[model samples]
Target chain A: MLELFQGPLFISILAAMVRIATPLLFSAMGELVTQRAGIWNISVEGTMLLGAVVAYVIASSTGSPWLALLVAVLACALLSLILSFVTIVLKSEQFIAGLALNLLASGLTLFWFQTYIIGRDPPKFAGFEAVEIPYLSDIPVLGTVLFSQRVLTYVSFLLPLAVWFFLYRTRYGLEVRCVGENPKALDVKGLSVGGRQCLAIMFGSVMSGFGGAFLMLGYSDRFVPDLIAGRGWLVVVAIIAGNWMPFRVVGAIFIFALLEAIGIHAQVVGVSIPHHVFLVLPYVASLVLLAGLRSRTHQPVALGIPYRRE
Target chain B: MAKAFSSLIVGAFGSQKALLGSLAKATPLLLVGLGTVIAFRAKIWNIGQEGQVLAGAMCAYWASLWIGPLPYLIAVAVLVLAGLAGGGVLGLLAGVLKTRFGTSEIISTVMLNYIVIFLLAYLLDGGPWMESGATVAYHQSPPVNAMLEWPTLFGQGAAKLHFGFILALGATALSALLLERTPLGYEIRAFGSNPTALRFRGTDISRLLLVVMLVSGALAGLAGAGELFGTSHRLRAETLLGIGSSGIVVAMVGGLRPSGAMLAALFFGALKSGAIYMRLQSGTPAGLVSAMEGLVLLFFLCAAVATRVHITVRSEAHA
Candidate 1:
């Protein structure tokens, strides 16, 4: 067991944790903002998947990661708009609408991939590559673990801080929070609750899009079916476990990523424990964390309800 | 494009064999949709039907192993009951968590879906229940005992339909009867319409939730059993997972009614059957059918909301 904590192994595990946490951080931060505004966008899973496919297709065809990321964000934002229209404009049930979007995304991605790319070797392009910070790379233990990452990973690390500031320090942030807690107040004050919630959903979806892009470009070489792999759900779980706080959401994401990284390392090192146990550790951990911490977390009062002008 | 469309129709229902195939595919959706209707009517939000189905399938498969030595009729009954219990317990856990700890059923159910799926994967992936000769690539349980299999209805060789279709129809009838005639059904509808009023009248909301979840989960589990005994003859992930989500679409498209779900399931099943045929004959991707299902659900949801809510257009002069 002591060998597990050796210099190289420890640093590598920490590095893997950081890498794995990047996408979750992006989506979780996004979800935190959306939830703060009182809309439960359950379509995060679907949006991430759509984003991954859009990014992969564009990147492979154009050979430009930046363009791919931009298109992916737009694609996911479009999906969020649909979700907003149904839930906010039509006043439909948020949960079912989100599930429908997920099914649509999954089916569309698989259909497009099969129709366009199947029966042939699809083109492959090197996605975003890791870059080391000039001065920080020389730091001992922390250097390789934190300083060397894809540009997306660096952005992900700073996102929670930015979200925290937006939520607490800005006047617009106060309106977003109020929209969730009491939309009637916002309506009486001549602010459009639906408009604010719409923007929040769009912002959250764009972040999820970036998360999906990072997953495909930084972690994987190709876009596979269901490539998001429930990371979107994990983002929702992280926000819940964190009590919807941006920094706390980061902590929750890191914990899940740590477990996932350890699970992968355990498989590589040929640990004697049952592989299934390791495989299921992160999911089980989320369940436990949710059941334990959810009681303490206060949800937005009108989180899932459709707000209307009275 | 017109030729391809005609062929798709021909592939789905042009022949007796295609019609039977569509019926077979619709059976599980109908059963699971009935289950979803019950829960949704009660405002339970049991979205973990996918996991419940897996749990039921695993349990039914396990039960079949021991019951094979008994009388065929008795064995089948035991297997069915076991499947129901397996799914019911999972649903009950979520319900209990919601009532006891104030957990959101939606989140818990969704999380349970993943947990149960992983558990199924663990069991099938060279675990104790895996077929002895199965390789790593093909994770599945051993074929269920022949006596435990649902008897086919028609077509001796390649076009065999199973008794599961009848079972699904019976479940639909039973659900409609229970929801419309019985006191429990009346109470369920009442709870959905006004839980506060029901609670005020001394009806136990938590207990009602538990019962609703159990019935809902049991129906989904029975669907899983039908798939195992009627169609696949073995426990596999691919056969089980898609039905749960599709069942939701069926339930919603049916307007959360049993009869409506039955009709919706038939339509979706026809599309699925036709898509398979379309893929084989005309090279259309089967995933398109799945997307169509999503589209139908989305449209129906929008319609459901639109009919109920009054959309007032604002004048630019007011601004």
Candidate 2:
């Protein structure tokens, strides 16, 4: 075990962990903002799927990763806008509508990916590259693990801080939180609840889309149907685990990534646990974390309820 | 009534084999859908129906492999039992977590799905569940004993329709009985509508969630058995992909009604089976009908949302 923690493999695992955490960070930030505006936005997975497909298509077609990423973010924003239209403006059951959107995203992406690519996996272009600062890459163990990765990895780290600033330190942020906590009070204050929620959904979509783009561009480098693979839901879990705070969300992502990393390591090393025990690790961990946090944390009073002005 | 009748006639018996194929495919979805309805009614979101289905299929396949020379009736019973146990245990774990830890059923069930997929993948790839020395690029276990399979209703040469259809119908009836005729069902409905109220009344929402999840999972598990015994007769990794999400669709479309689930499941089964047939017939790209499936869901969501909007407006007007 000491040997396992002492060297390059440790650095590799840390780097991989950050990469894994990037999507969750994007999604958690998105979810936090949405919740802050009083919407659950369960369509995070569907939006991310759409973003991945659109990003992969754009990048593969134009061979411009940056342009591809922009398009993906826009696609997710559009998806959020639609969700906002139905749930916020139309006053729908956010949960059911979100689930339907997710199903639609999955079906549509699978259909197109299957159609265009036939049987082969979707094509990939050069994805976003990692940046090395002049002196940062030379630091010892921490340097290799933390400083070395794709741009999205660093962006993921920066995003939480950005989210924290926007959420707690800004006027718009305060308004959003107020709206979430008590929409009627905010309505009395003359803030448009629907407008704020729609904005939050858009903000969340940007992060989710970035996360989706990262899945194809940064992690796997090719789009597969069902590419997000429950990461969207995991992001929601991270939001709750982090107590809806941006920085704390990283810890939740770390716990999940760590569980997954350990499971992969065990399998790679051929450790003889009953295969089912190892298979169920992350889910068990998530359940435990969720249970532990349930009592201690305070969720927004209006988290999943749709808001309409009387 | 007349419109529904026309659609039903066209949908069910537009052709000879169409009705049979539709029913055959509907069996698994109907079972899974009814189970989902049970959980949904209890406010326990058990989305791992596909995993339960796969687990049931694997258990049944495994049972048939080992329980050789047993009477056909006994073998079939063991297969169904094994499926129920495997799925029930998985559901029980989810239920416990939801009850004890306050974890969201949605997240737990989704993650459990991945675990099931990768676990099955591992089994077929090289682990204990693999059939040995397979030449096919894909990994799958051997077919179950032919004698253990369900018999066809119409004729020997009829397409793959079998007793699983009847089993699914029976499950639907049981689901209705469970929800409507029993005190337990009353508690499930009450708990689902208001868990906090149930807690105040000392009804134990956690226990209810757990029981409902287990029962739901067991039903989904039996669906897997039906799929195996009725048609494919083998457990393949290919079956798990879309079935779970489709169950959600069925549950929603049914308005969480047990009989409605049976109907919705039949519709989806036909959609799926017919989509393939239409694809093969039309030479429309294989993905076209899938795209239609996605489009239909999207429209369905829009309609639901629109309805909500109308209700809110009406209530506001009255208020």
Candidate 3:
């Protein structure tokens, strides 16, 4: 246990924790914005999968990580638009459609991967580079803990603040909240509720896609099947656990990441505890957190239900 | 439906070997779909059926691997019980979360599915169940004793049709009876169709939930056994992982009725078996069945919602 806390090991775990938390951060932020606009885009997982696979394919082909990231975000945004067309325009169920989209993404990606992208073993390309802060790099523990990280990780850390500012300080953000709370009232006021939801979902899709990109290029540096690995679902839990607040959501993501780190660390150090028992910690914690949050008063009034003008 | 049948028949039974393979592939989906039907009738959104099936397979395989020299009948019973226990426990966990804390079972069960997959991966790679020896390549748990393997009722060689297919049929029959002819069946139907009635009658929602979830999980656990004792005879990483998704498609298509689930399961099972044949015959890419499953689900949900919307529109126009 003490050996696990050595400088390099501790730093590596912290880095891994940050890496894991980045995608959750991006996804939760996207989900928060979507809910604020009255659309529950539960297809975050699907969008992330699309992003990861597309990004990996592009990166492998062109050897340009930035271009790969661009394609990933754009492709997933298009997928999100398709989802919005079905749910927002056709009045489909959000949860059911979201689940279908996830299945479609998983199936299509795997089919292509098997058919086309076989020989590359680890799905290789140049991964994201760490961005080291100039002055902060020498600051004892804080330097290793925070300043030395990937560019995506830094963006992930700053995203909650940006999202918080957008939601709380912008007129459009207020409009989104109004639409979520009472789409009928928004329609009465001649505001396009459907339009706002469409925009929100697209925005959420891009962020989720970026989150997927982070998984491939920033952390794992390789694309395995289902590589997003329930991080999207974990982000959904973080959204609830944080009571839908941006900062609180980050805290929730961190808690889960810390639990994951502990589990991984416990195994790495060859601890005597049954590793599977430790593996169950994050899920059980999610269950407990979800249970404890039953009384929270911040749920969107019209979440998961379709809306149309009367 | 007829067009689908004609295509399905041509695709599945077009050749002698094709007929056998389809039956082999359909067994797991049939078991999973039957389990899904029970839970859906109780209005329990059990998305963990896949995970439950995985857990069931693991436990059944574990039992077979460890409990040696036991009588064959006792071993089989223990294997089935192990699956039931595994699935029931997971379902009961979902139930507790639902009743005691008001957590959404749909989300919880879905999350549990991922957790189980990860747990299985870990188990196969360096965990307790890991096969001893070289660590460079993938390692797996030891296969079950050959004596413990389920017998094929028909066909030889590649056309093996095991007893699990019969088990699936018996499960569907038993589920139909339990759901249509008992007091508990009435309660399940009542709860799903209208939960307000159960609340009004002072029936403990928590207790009802426990029973429903246990039954749901147990049946799914049997699906795991079907894969293990019936086919693979060993627990592997991907075993029974996606059956939950297929089960959901089946349940939705069947409208949550037991008889409907049986038909839907057969439909899906045939689709899957046919899809494999489709891959072999047409050189169609694999994972097409997955997309087709999604398409079927999308069509079903759209149909349900459209009908509901039409009714609302008509009623509102009348008002």
Candidate 4:
């Protein structure tokens, strides 16, 4: 067990954690923007599943991971329209709308999976390979853990900084924040609250789509029904546990990624505990994290409330 | 397609056996849906019905081990109580999380669900509950003691409806009464509509939330117990998992009313029952039903919003 913490095993685990954090980084950053705009979009899970499914389909059929990623994001964007209507347009309960979208995604995925993928041998896709940068990749442990990763992983690593910039340093970012904190002010300013929310939702869903696509094409060659599993929900938790801040949320995402990486490596590390304990750690941690945080000062004022002319 | 549709109808209702089977299926759904209806009516959103149901069955199974010798009637009664206690306790836990810690019930319930599911997987896979035999161990408990099985109401074979149907019916009536004729029910509805007013009116909002979770979780828990003791007669996660989500769907489709949930449960029960025959007869995959559920839910959500306001499709003539 002590050996698990030392030597090459620890390095490999850190490297794996970095790789695993890629999809979550893409998702958490996107959801942070949407939540900042005061749109409590919980449909991240469903959108992720749709993204994975589309990625699997396009990658196998067209033989282009890039094309698959594009189509997957596009598909999720289209699906977000349904959510936008039910949530932003109808002004219904945001949670309920989110739940409905999740159910729809899983049900549709099951149907499609059974209809096509069940009987036939699944088609193989050309998945993303790890790319090694020249000098950066040679920088000992730090270099291997950070520089030598798939292309998308590198993109995701820089996403949070980009998000922090977008959310804090940009004009539209302030408007988005205003829409969440005081939609009435935005409304008074003659800015369209619903329109801002719609775009935010679209962006959030698209990023989740990227996560799902990467989960499919970045690592695996085939797709399964539970591919996204609870990662989407984990992304939502990351947003909240991070107190809805850009960097803090990234911190939370890495924590989850680290736990999951350790869980995956526990058996190989010769731990005495049952695998289930490790598998369940992230969820158990989420409860404890939420209970301990208790700070809602940073939460958006109208996060889940549907905005309407009063 | 038409033939497949007809076959599905026949599979669900053509024979007395099929009808009884469908009713048996509806028992758990109705129970869980009733639990959902009350909670949703109050807008509590206890989405952990899945875990609650599992807890209920697990509790009842534990009770049976220690029950020892007793009269048949008393034994069954104890088991029923155990079932309720199991689910109610889990619900109360969520209630505490919300009332004390300020954790959102939505996130907490969902997290608890994963925890419970993992716990069960542990229990069944290699923990004490794994079915012991010469063959590879399945992730399930040994068949429930046959002597303790809930008595059948009527019919025979796989379609024999168990006594849980009666419990479910009684629960429906009780839920209707609780929501319509009781003060607590009034408080629940009022809480959903306006929590601030209820607080001003001297309601202990925390207690109300706890009660809501307890009742919602208990109802779902009962469904799990019913599925275990009354139908499957074995403790298995696969049999119990979908009932919670299906119940939620039933509650939503029923417009979060007791009577409406009953009808939706029956409809979905039939859909589920018929899916088997539909697959065999017309080669339509059963997964289509699950997909249809999502579509129906999305449709209903939109319809509720659409129906709430009088859309002025045509403009009034100018004077």
Indicate the residue-level lDDT of A146 in model 1.
96
Q: lDDT, candidate 4, residue B140?
A: 87
- Per-residue lDDT, model 3, residue B24, is 74
lDDT tens string, model 2, B1-319? 3443344345455776777777777788888888889988877778888788887777777777788688777777888898887778778877887767777777777777777777887777676767777766366766767888877775344356787778888888988998999988999898879878877988866667778988998988888877777777667878655676677778778879988888888888777666655555543443443455555655676777677779989999999
Ranking by lDDT: 4, 1, 3, 2
For each candidate, the alpha-carbon lDDT, in order, equals: 0.86, 0.77, 0.80, 0.88
- What is candidate 1's DockQ? 0.67
lDDT of 4: 0.88
- Each model's DockQ score: 0.67, 0.46, 0.51, 0.73
Docking class of 4: medium
Chain A structural similarity (TM-score) per candidate? 0.96, 0.93, 0.95, 0.97
Please give the lDDT score at residue B160 for candidate 3. Answer: 70
**Model 2: CA > 4 A from native:** A1-3, A120-124, A259-281, A308-310, B1-14, B155-158, B196-202, B285-294, B305-319
TM-score for candidate 2, please give it: 0.91
TM-score against truth, every candidate: 0.96, 0.91, 0.90, 0.96
Candidate 2, residue B7: Cα displacement in angstroms equals: 17
TM accuracy, model 4: 0.96
lDDT for each residue of candidate 2 in A1-310, tens digit (9 for 90 to 100): 3444656767776777777788878888888888878887788888888888888889899999889999999988888877887777767667777777787787777667666886665575878887765578789877777787777788788888888898899999998998888999988977788888889989988888998998888877566786787788878878887787777778888888776666556666666665556556766677667878874355788888776556
Over A128-242, each residue of candidate 3 has an lDDT whose tens digit, in order, gives 8888999997788778778888888888898999999888899888888877778888889888989999989998999999999888888775667778767787888888778
Q: Show where candidate 4 strays beyond 4 Å.
A: B311-319
Tens digit of per-residue lDDT, candidate 1, span A2-77: 5556889878889999999999988888888888888888888988898889889899999999899999999888
